[model samples]
Target: MSLTLSLQRSLQQTPARTATIFGTRRRSFREHGDRVARLAAALRSQGLQANDRVGILAHNSDRFLECIMGVWWAGGVLNPVNIRWSVPEIVYSLDDCDTRILIVDKAFAALAPRIGATARHAPLFVYADDGAAPPGMLSFEDLMEQHEPVEDAGRSGNDLACIMYTGGTTGHPKGVMQSHMNLWSAATMRLSETPILRGSTSLHVVPLFHIAGLGRVVMQSIAGECQAVLPGFDAGAVLEIIERERITDTVMVPTMIQAVLNHPDFDQRDLSSWRRLGYGASPSASVMVEQAVQKLPNVELSHAYGLTEACPVISSSGPAHHSEDARKSGLSRSAGHPAFGVLVRIVDAGGREVPRGVVGEITARGPNIMLGYWNKPEETAKALRDGWLFTGDGGYLDADGNLFIVDRIKDMIVSGGENIYSAEVENAIAQHPAVAMCAVIGIPHEKWGEAVHAVVVCKPGAELDEEAVRTHCRERIAGYKCPKTVAFRDALPLSSAGKILKRDLREPFWAHRGSA
Candidate 1:
């Protein structure tokens, strides 16, 4: 079913029920529906057509949710830009996907001019905050005020729904094209296995740009539940909202979960309303998992494993896998079994299935798999082979079919729930004049799950320091993607073909620890 159908269903069945809550502002299903319809009309007035790409660069808010539904209702494809990206990176995504309209929240309003100047298509900007619109931009509130509610476009099935830009292995971003069917299938599969009770309140702490966060929004909409949103994740704020909203369910990365557990007010807050806590985007250390189980005995712990290409979920491990007995059997560490309606396999380099218990490249196939990468035919073909999406991850399955992730074949570093491509970081570092060669790897981190570490060889007689390399990288990439530590190396380990052997760089940090 189309995503718009979810809102329609809620409006018909629970029109008077709360639909969104942000700070003191609240909207019922009826009010939300009217606003979404008006937003669609506003979009159409700006020449938005069927399948047009629309971008939103903003923090989590009720308005962001409105933009999502409004875009779809306007028959436009959703292009949720990464909020952490650098200006150039953001421009690349907008240009790459030809997003014609961009919705900017107050936090990102200052960057609109730079983005407009750099982006090839030069998107029309819509200020989505409560304040007055800046010059050359249309006020989001004004648009809704001026336009009349419009009809749904009724697009469904394989129609392109989203073009989510993910970090590429080649020093750029690639747009993952997800169809309406892909998102609906993934959401339904997740809900079928772990159903949401009607009227249950879900707290949205994660950023709306990520697939996990965005997918949960869709799932909540389909379930016709109230969603309490936070502008961003803050340990104290999250706890306060959970108690105030009487939130029943929420999802976060392991890093976020750890932050909440460590918050001084975590125990003082009235958190009895919480029932389910979902964590993923990176593997959880056994110690952390045990702590969560002991500290939140009444709460159900769920783990999901997937990438953007799978519409972000290939498998999930529910509370059963987080039990004490399961932890003793080491099953708690597993990524869990293949999700319902999804088929997963462990394969060798030749694409042949490997024996059980052997680590190999993970592959998945399902109705929820992404349509393909936008504007990259060769890359898309490489990823999707013979109807199977090759997930660049090393994993194994036990005889009982428990999936365990061992390593990241793509050398991707997930820090604070954000994917940082080594190639992208390396390219940024190599541009520094003093750097002759560089390699980036994810080292063990106590707080962020994995820290981006860089190994660099300076030009002969040239000088550089850790901070210098980090500062240089910061100017080019996001602050989080910059190397937390930089080691000056005489040379990076190289293979016979002169390719940098990153395994050697990661060996020292991960020698006694499990792969993150």
Candidate 2:
């Protein structure tokens, strides 16, 4: 069945059950279903048609969740704008996908005019804030009040569900086309592997724009579980919610988990209701994992590894892998075996499967694999070959089938749950008039797992400093994509072919890092 059908099924079976909680706002399944239907009707009233793209630029809230369901319900594709991206990045995605309608919250209201000015086809702005609509924007509540509930559009199977834009190696963003079946399969496969607990109440603090966060939402909906969403992450706030709301399940990146654990009130909170803690987007430090195990001994920990193109669940290391014996055996560091219904292989450049324990590019074939890259025939051909989605990740699988990540073949850095491509950062840095050349690389970071670091060679007699280079990048890209550390260099190490040798550049910083 489709995502729309799943929501309807929840409404039919658990109409009176609490569906969502955002701050003091609580919605029962029946109320949420009615709201979703009205929102779908509202979208149609605002010129949305079958397969039209609708954008949402907001923080994690119940309204954000509603917008996601509403898009699918109205037979429109979703383009959830990355909350951390700069205005230019957001506008690029909207323009690239030709999104015609955008929903903005109070947090992003100021960016609405800029986006409208830059986008080729200015989107109809709908303010998702609880208060009155801002100037030149339609009120979300008003639309709901004016429109009557509408029937589901009944789109399912291979129909496009979302166009998730991911960082590109070519210094641009590529929209990964996720079909309804892809997302459905991903959520089902994950549930098969790790069944959801009955009466589960999940805390959603991770940004819904990311695959990890959206995947959780889909999974929770399928299971008819209640979700309590936070607008953004705050360590103390999460602890308080877990205690007060009796949150049982939640997903977070390692950096966020570390921050929560480091908070002074962590031990003072009553977190006994937190039964499951899923972490991903980057590997967790062994020290942090150990501390979590020590402090929250009863909580089951899991880690997943996937890319947006895979509809995001390729493999998951479950609680068993986080056990003391498994940790001692170093299995906790593995990305784990392929998820149910997913086939994973390590293949060489020619697409031939490699021998076990041999490092090669990770390739996956599954119903969860994305349709293709939007408006990028060349990239689609390159990534999807012979029915296999070639993930540009360097990894090896042991005889026991546990996947061990070695490095990134595409030079992508995941810092604080955000993907930052070296090419993007380098492109921004090179735009500085004083910069002659620059290469960006991922370096080990204690809190973020990996940080974007840049090594630059300035032009002769050109005055440039680390702050100058960083400031220039911030103006071009998101702050998170900017290099956290800058090192000036006379020249970069190059291969015989005149190509920059990134391995050589990364060696010094990662030389001491032991196998995870």
Candidate 3:
């Protein structure tokens, strides 16, 4: 079914129930359904064609949800822009995807001029806000404010739904084309993986541009749950909302998690309503996960493993496993079993099956798999060959069929011809009490072809120096894998999804040095 149907089904069954709570704007299922129907009709009038891309350059807001359903209703696809992207990056995405309609919220209205100028290629532009629209722009409210409810766009199953653009870390970012059914399948199945997100009031703290954020919206809608949105993530602001709204579930990356945990009022806050802490985009540190369980007591920690290409979910580590084996390390280290209705395989370089416990590329195949990259046929073939999505990640399955992500073979650093997995080095570096976060990458070396370089963030009040961190790694990992050079930073670069952008972190240093 189309994700739009999820909302329609919910609204039809529970018209009086709250569909979404947008701060002061309470939208009951009946209210939202009428507006969604109207907006869909209006968009159809504006000439939106089936499978056309409609870009939303907004943060979390009621209009964002409205646009999502409206686009599907109008027989178009939603291309939610990453709110954190620079204006130029936004331009690239809208242009690359050939978006016909651009939706801008008040927060990014000022940027509309530049974005509009660059997006002259688009056919239409609309501004969304409770207030007035910028000059030369159409009003989002007017389009839906008075129109009548209409029929569904009738696009579902393999019909294109959304094109989530990845952060352009390597070269230009490519769009991962997800179909309506592909995402819906991932969403409904995810409830089985993360039950707390079902029939619960969720907060969109993560940027809507990401798979995690968008997937949550569809899943919650299917379960007929209420969603409350925050424009963007702010630690103190999040804590205040959690307490005030009695938020039951939300997904966050490790950085956001750390920010909230370190908030001065964290311990004293009455955040007892939170039911689930869904974390992904990167591995959650064992210490932080353990501490959160002890401190929150009420919240469950669940981990998901996937990429944009997999419609973003392949496996999940939930609270049941957390209670059984995570007090120490065994299950905590695993990224849970393959997700429901999903198949995972670890294969060697030759595409042959590898024995359990031997690290190999983790590949997946299922209904949730993305069709292909928007226009990169070669890369698409490389990724989706043999009916399996070959994720570049390196890991292995255990005797009990639990997967343990040992390292990223694609992200491996080679120094003096010796291979080093960044996760291995980062894990050891995280052990140092003075370190907050770290990223290890291969830097150009005149003789060794490439050398290990460390980019690190130190804990507040800690004075750990570069040499000291090098010594720590040297003592734990292979001596050659230790950083030959270290750069200290207050924070590392992260993608909107909260994964460390190693490509972004490595670009400047290697701009003129090597092909890294």
Candidate 4:
């Protein structure tokens, strides 16, 4: 079955159920289906071909979900533009993908003309805001109003469902191809019929452009549950929505969760409806995890581990994963076992599986694995081989099979011919009293191949001295693993998912040097 079939199934099973809640607006499955069918017919009559990429450049709304279903119903692939990107960045993505249509909303209506200017192929532009089709633009409602509610396009499994553009940390963003089956499998990994997930009203604050946000959409659509979507994450806004909507389950990266927990109105908001809170992106600190559990004892904590290429859900530590021993013994740092239907193994450079508990590249094999990079055969070849996607992550599995991801493969610092995993050093530094967050990178040195350098964001009202940090690490890790130079910042640049943008951190220092 395809994503289209799933949507059709939900529409048939629960016609009256509230499918989407965007601010005060709500749409039931039956209503959503009708709108989507009309829009799909509109798109098809406008010459939208099977697998042609249609772009969406806006925030969360009922219209966002509508556009998604409309695209699938019309047998088109989705190319969601990054909201954080600059005009040129967005333009570059649209140009690179050759997207023939763009669906935008009221929030980004101003940038519509600008995005249109740089689009090389000059695709059709549709506004989700007003039915009025602007000069040189098509109206979203016009599509729905014009087309007939015909049968589904019947795009089957393995068909290109989306071309998700990865934010270019190194350079231009590249589209990652994902099939309907790939996404379906990833959804099963978390929101399956497990008693832990059923009957939960999922809150979506993350932007739809990112995999994590889209991941929430996947879960909600399959489970046939209600989604309370916030246009963008505002601390007060999120808190108010939770209490007002009686949201039951939500997922976010640690950064957003930290902000929500630190919000002044957090206690004032009635969050008793929340039962399970899933956090990921960057691993949570022991202290932060402890505080969350203490503050929200009624909520079960789950963590997911995934990259954009993996249909984004690789493995998850579910509600049942939390244990008193794990919290006390600090074993909660582990990312937990491989996701169901996903085969994970640590492999060496030659693609041979390494011994358990050995640090090597993480490889994942599943239907959830992405088809490949869009239109780039060589790059696709590098990623997908023998049905195994070689994930460029450095991690290990314990004898008990709990996988622990340390850092990116490129982030490992090789100094004096010894491999020093940056995450190990960063974790050590993070444990210091003064360090709020830290990223360790290698800097060129004449004597060693690279020297361990620490860029730390110090905690509020705390003083961090290089000597104190170095001394603290010497006690816990190898002496050579300690940072030779510590640089202080108010905060480290992070991705929307809260993962430290190590490439951004390292580029300033290493860009002029010969090697990474």
Candidate 5:
């Protein structure tokens, strides 16, 4: 019925089964359940009440998983702090949410003093890192040992569950409020579409603070499967874990997948146990998809497309969509069909549905959609209109009802009179053998209202000039779609989630022109 109930079911059904693996440490369902209950008691003792916000700023670890469960068990809301955020960003979220309790891992303990000093309310700090608790903080292990195990609060349905902060690529991060029903429905609906393998072992490489990673965690818990938690993503380390732990399934962004494929250990590692790979967050190049298919012939690939406001998954492209036949039909490039129990439509600016094959804003409606943005009613009103979450993404549905994402609505380039989707241009650039990664943005032009410009990262030892890049794009796309100027970099700026930061790329050019 709820996330807590799901965990209880798993605990009841498989008390002795392995629940989580972090490095050399392993915990059974019973052990994890007991710790979760005690942690809940500890939080309650520290003044956590129904709907109170508790924060966790940590990397992926068993404690991160426990912190998530413990918050709900204590009848509190979770605000998982972004590990990549600076002290100011972290303070803004905590202050905005009025969080009074924060759990920090060793990697982020240094941030406690700064966050406590700046936040609206100085929070009680619980150190979950290795060794003893630093000065003023409470030790997570000590709390578990000292407190009595408490009963589950039995929170379910519309009860507030989490306030996940967005990446803030556009502006200050807004907390997306997720209810118990929203997250439960999202995990269940996704599983209904792509059933998890029984007794499977999943690896957690993505940050638990993000929707994609946290959503996967909820799904894995509901399935009562084994989870292996990684501190963070390391290409070689991931490969080693797959071989050593016999990880059966995992989720990653396309960029992470590409890194794994490009790793030196990729060819040498014994990864036969790995069966399913789910990727999303950004569009995948056809070339990279081909590389993944070639390198991991036995692995089934799936893609999810959604944003934080939608509880993260509105549609999923399954293994069938990645087949050779589907690839040839261009279905592989599509964001796939609307997810189970979710309604999706491409709507024009007036909120009317656009005809198939016409590009428009992608909107979705479902029980899984967030309650609203936390403490921002006006912004929430703008995002959720007439029961539909108007996703600021430009895309179209094909005749076959497959959704093809073009680009973020804000990222589309209007060159002269033509509308150029950056994804299309970037995809074309990716096809070139020498290009490793690329991001296309619109810049102010004297002749054209906006010019198509590209920032490219070439493959190692690969040389590419601006004209050569333009020539390559011209061969595959229209002249207006080709980049008028190309700048090469050893690497492209990437967000923590592995998405290209186009806002960062566009800032310099637009700043001088005094245009967005």
Candidate 6:
């Protein structure tokens, strides 16, 4: 069915109930639904035809949620801009998808002019920030005020819903085309596995551009509960919000969980209201999990494992897997069993199904799987083979069908819960004037799960330092994707065919730890 059906149900059943909380501002479902409908009418007035792509460049907010619903309500595909992306990266996505209108907040309003100048067609901008609309742009509030509420477009099934861009293996981001059914299946699948409590208020700290964060938003929408919105993550703010808002449910990456526990005011806060805590996006350390269990004794801790192509949930480990005995047996570290209605398999290089307990590429089949990569048939073909999405992660299934992620077959790094492809970083490093050749790899990091490390061989007569390398990369890519540490090398280890041996480069760092 259509995602808008949830909004309709909320309006009919719980119209007066609080739907969103942002700072001191609150909106009931009736208010939220009205705004969403008006926003939809405004989008149609702006020439948003059925299935047309609309982009949103902003931090997480109530307005962002409304914009997402509004676009879908108007039967348009969403292109949620990644806040971490550089101007070039942002422009590439807009141009690649031909997004005709961009809804931007004050944080990214400055980049609009450059993006407008660069994209194939300059998009009409709708300012969604707190202040007055900037020059030559329409105000978000004015649009809702001017347009009357319209009926939902009722798009469903295989109709495209979102084109979420993820870090690409070949250095440019690939837009993953998710259908309405895919998103619906993803949210419902999670609901079947772990039902949300009635009237539960969930907190939003993660970026809405990511699948995990947006998936939670959709789940909350369907559950018709309250959502406490935040622009971004801050440990102190998170603690204060949870205690202030009485948030009952929330999810975050392991890094965020660790930060919240490590906060100076952790023990002083009244986090007793929080009942369920979900952690994922990166592997969690047992020490962090133990600290969470010990500190928040009443809360339930769960973990999920998936990728963008799966609309993001392939497997989830519930509270049972986080039990004391499970932790001692290392079952807590497993990604848990396959999600309901999902088919997971560990396959060999030739796409042959490998026996359980044998490490291989993780492939998943389900209705939640994305339609395909936007306009990249070859890449899509390689990813979706024989109705199964061949996830580039190397993992194995235990006897109980629990997935254990060992290594990433793709040249990628997950730093602070954000995916950073090594090729993207290496492409930036090789552009440096003093670099002859370079390779990037993930190294063990205490704070971030993994840090981007660059191994470089500068030209024989030229010179380069860590700062120079980092500075150069920062100019080309997002700051997080840049190398956290750079090492000078006479030459990198290579295989027989002259390919750089990245495994050898990562050996010393991961040897004692046992995995990358």
Task: For each candidate in turn, give its C-alpha RMSD to the true structure in angstroms.
Answer: 11.0, 11.1, 2.1, 2.1, 1.0, 10.9
lDDT of each: 0.87, 0.87, 0.82, 0.82, 0.91, 0.88
Which model, 1 or 6, shows the larger lDDT? 6
User: Which runs in model 5 stand beyond 4 Å of their true positions?
Assistant: 514-516
Q: List the residue pairs that clash in candidate 5.
A: none
Over 28-140, each residue of candidate 5 has an lDDT whose tens digit, in order, gives: 99999999999999999988889999999999999999999999999999999898899999999999999999999998898889988888888999999789999999999
Candidate 2 overall lDDT versus native = 0.87
lDDT per residue, candidate 4, 135-218, as tens digits?
Answer: 777788877878779788888689989889887766567789989888878887765524335666788888888888887787
What does candidate 3 score on TM?
0.94
Lowest lDDT 10-residue stretch of candidate 3: 191-200
Q: Which ten residues in a row have the lowest lDDT in candidate 6?
A: 492-501
TM-score of each: 0.82, 0.81, 0.94, 0.94, 0.99, 0.82
Clashes of each: 0, 0, 0, 0, 0, 0
The TM-score that candidate 4 achieves is 0.94
Best by TM-score: 5
Tens-digit lDDT track of model 3 for 1-516: 777778778877889988887777888988888888888888778777888889998878887888888888888988988888898888888888888788888888888778777764843778888877778888988877667788887788899999999876567888899998789888877877555445578888888778888888888888888988887888998898888888898888877887888899897778878988888766536656766777778888888888888878899888876774565546776788998989999999998989998888999999999999898899799989889999889988999888777566757776777767777777778778888888888877789977888888988899888889988887888787788898999988776566788877878878886565
> Which candidate tops lDDT?
5
Candidate 2 lowest-lDDT run of ten: 494-503
Candidate 5: Cα lDDT at 204: 93
TM-score of 2: 0.81
Q: Which candidate do you rate higher for TM-score, 1 or 5?
A: 5
How much is the lDDT of residue 214 in candidate 6? 83
Clashing pairs in 4: none
